[model samples]
Target: MKKTVRLILPVLAALTLAQAAQATTPSRVVQGTTELEGEVAKLGETFTLGKQSPLNFTLLKVEYSVGHVVIGNTVYSPKAAEKLLLLHFAVHNPQRRDVRYYWPDLKFTAVDAQDRNHPYAQAVARDGTTERLEINLKPAQKVNVLTVIRVPAGGGVPKLLVQREAALLRYDLRGQVQPLPKAVADPTDTSGATPLTQVPAALKTFNPLERFDVRLDDVKFTGEALNGKAPAAGQRYLSAVFTLRNMEPGGGRYAWSDFKPMLRDADGERVEYNGLLLKASRDETAGGTLGAGEEVRVRFFFALPANVNGQTLTLADGTGRAYVYDVSGVR
Candidate 1:
């Protein structure tokens, strides 16, 4: 009887150990948020706000506030005075080089208990108290940045979804919700030096003065592609081709809006478009995202007076930096 009892006790001990291991086993969840610990640079683990330290950079603390006007020591408000959800995070940069913190690239999405997704809110502060999410950090620089999100009146605990280089970091708001104020617009002034109003004497097929890896080439005057489409009473068509090359390894976003096109005739009078929608008249830079290591060809059409001898294509970057291309006497 003693020998039988000893064998039975060993079997019970083994079963108890198995059950304890199963209960404490961690589940590996992806994308969605979960509790994480220790170094997760490559582990792709989720971290609780202000709890676990990050391997890349420490996430010091997390704060949340709701409503339009959050008044305490200083007012924390954003534009429109609409209901908003704000998430303040303290982050440190442990890299050697300077890192730029941009809110758009962070791609933060908030979800409420009702299974509703609230995207990041676009807000401008009235007194400019809140810093723009765009920050340039030096090595070992620690900064506290906040993201404003437009949320509904009363949503229970908010859970945020954050993705970083294929890793997911989830955060739930466990703080107080505060009010914000309406945003005010920043004033615009034109007190800077005037742009160069002269076209260059020496012109070539392409100019090398491009800020964004784009070249202006194949500029000439041709009525052959007019296809019998008559110009206005005293107007003529001008054609120019733009070639954009992505210098980076990844895809680069290029838009025509980056180049504010303005044409000035020999009389220095600004010329406008003639609404010519020819087959080649479509602006290639319109509504297209440039791919990496890819070359894009875009053509632009401009209408000018027939008697215009010399015209200048003035491309400005809206920051006082202007590049003028001489389009006079193009064959």
Candidate 2:
């Protein structure tokens, strides 16, 4: 009788331990709110996952997916046509906080007909979509946000970032996400980053860039600079350009709207894209501006950590209408 009683006590202890281990994952029982924890586990005859501290309640989960970038055949003139590259993204934030955070300054860059890294406009997903969720937390929450990227999509462009996500802490930008592909020769490296290292680049999209026609020669690009880093991952500064010249001066300055831009590598994968985006200011060196029919080179400089995936200079633009151009080389 004594031996049987001792055996029962041991079994009961083991059962308690098993219950604790199973609590780490989301289960059918925890239907209202889900909690994710980063834990440490030691493997011996048996394994036990030890819990560490949890992150801010502001963040529950950030999950996303890329779809595709659709191209159109319509032509808008010169530097004012549509180079629509659809970046389909789905972001799922399952937290209970109305996250009020400053936005990171991000841009989508791509190479142009001249094989230069040009930047483009900031893109956004349609409102009221499952992918466009911006909410205040109520203890338990789950929301999905999508971003539609329609920037410059073309050839010779090494890479393009269809969509982007920004992260930060202590009032400083921490990380970012954009759409980019690996180069075949060095498909694992970002400028100098290791392929195995998960250095935050941009978000990878399922969709591809769609090509279109627009005027080239009659339009020129001057660089613009900004203070705040790109809203996307690991950005330092934002540089962009406005129209430099139109053969007839003001002949075709305001002929288009919805200007878009992108960046590509020598191998032609879009690294970044921006639509309706703007630069940041810091009092004295406030953001720069451009004027139509104006021909002067403008550029703002920024940097990325040497060990992380960095940003290179690039350019592109479109009006989302009909257009054409005759481009001259500038190198």
Candidate 3:
């Protein structure tokens, strides 16, 4: 009788252990809200809110801190018995038109181990500012977003809950907690004044406007002063002359707005346009109609950081066709 009882006890012990292990294992599939009846996703996975929405979300990483969290120059602390949870993710807009969104549009919640819910506390912007969370996304634009939530301390892995109108999504952040990364320096800083590569001068032409063929006549880097007036500190000016000819057999209207000119530095960062200088200068182009075979010379001005060297000029037509010109050698 004793031997029989021992065999049964061993079998019961093995069954209990198996059940405990299964309970702790993370499940990839989870239930969604009523709107998203069939959607399921795991952490580090990308998912869309719904078929009608053009927004896509991907949870990249998650971090938790029991101590104070530092963002920019401000430090945030959680209430007693709670910890600060940081969620790093990317929000992407794939549509052609611009999409504007505010934080309240997507309801966010953090579910702790005890099944208690916590709301989002704050959001950090690209500049590390914890102000209002609002963004305008251009076509094919993706922006990284950081959200902070306060969850009960000593809770196991928490799950992120997001709801957008009719769709709801959840991500189980289990075994994915990582140490907060050190703050990274801004990549767009050009204060080092690195010299740009010089490209040989050449004649470049672009048909950026309807029924118009434009030829680049010359590009000149006019230092600081325009019409005897200098720009504010840390700014310079550039001027480019283009010869535009009407290509249509009939007369056609032409305007500077027809061709949107953009200047970029060696790192592909945009150089701001100086409207004040253009308004004051006599070389600014004017809108007019041109007859067939008529050609006119137009000059455009751009403002750039004093430490930056302009590298390329991008011209876009009304139809969104773009043409690039090398201007690194203009001095």
Candidate 4:
């Protein structure tokens, strides 16, 4: 009986210690706000804005540093004695239809400890895409926004000031700012000239527009003039052929220009299309109304440095999505 009792006592004590350790372990942090309207809200709190078409906004987190900040593939640094502040937040539109809004539209300003006001420098998406001053949000859509601001390094806790037509909204950012972390190396970094994936030659259709389909057919590079149109000195012409089709029940307008095509090399160098060359080609399918089930072949021309190789053609819809086509064979 004594031996059994001793064994049971050790087991019970071990179980209790394990349970205590588990209870003391920290869990994930939940972000929320505890401030009311007309009062300065703190970080992790949700604030309501707008009157008729209301928007629920929450400041999730903030990062500040005097060093460089990386947005997408670009790096931004502040001047001496200045630090960059990044405010990350979410905005929701609860309307039934699409609503257009922007950070600047809110008339946001940052008030420093010295009572100096600083306007927003810029805003970008997580992928580093620059956010225009106006963006359309579908009903019930939520988007994460990042805004960059420059403030004095010694500036005491800054407050966010929002100007509305009826009342002003303020957010206290004390104890919410954290030091910016070192940027991790991106696997897709092209500093070493890593090549993009080669798109298969098989027909791969991309629907960049509503009720429209597009597919790359061929790509060619030439140093000579094309149909009496010659490229400038030390430059060559790259022509990409594509097939466009309309799938809408009713006729719809289709234009190659709508794709907003651009060429990016493996080294991140970009080149723009030659508008004159496109107009000079006079491809009947360049811009026209396509009936249902009708398709047309279109060609676009771009002038690039004679030495550029391993390039990719990027075509974007106005809605922020882009399609990439490998043009490494163009060399």
What's the lDDT for all of these models?
0.49, 0.29, 0.63, 0.62
TM-score result, candidate 1 = 0.34
In angstroms, give how far residue 149 of model 1 lies from its true place. Answer: 31
Ranking by TM-score: 3, 4, 1, 2
Candidate 2 lowest-lDDT run of ten: 41-50
TM-score per model over all chains:
0.34, 0.22, 0.40, 0.40
Cα lDDT of model 2 by residue, 40-145, tens digit:
2111111111122111211111111122221121211212222323223222223344432111222334334454544442333322432223344343332322
Per-residue lDDT of model 4, residues 134-208, tens digit only: 568898787877777777655344588765454467877765666432231113532211112222233356432
**Candidate 4: where are CA atoms >4 Å away?**
1-37, 67-76, 122-134, 180-331
What C-alpha lDDT does candidate 2 achieve relative to the native structure? 0.29
Error of 2 at 154 (Å): 3.8
- Candidate 1 clashes: the total is 10
lDDT of 3 by residue, 201-307 (tens): 24564442335666777777776456456766787777777778765555677775567677888678987544322322364436678876698777777877777
The clash count for each model shown is 10, 85, 0, 2
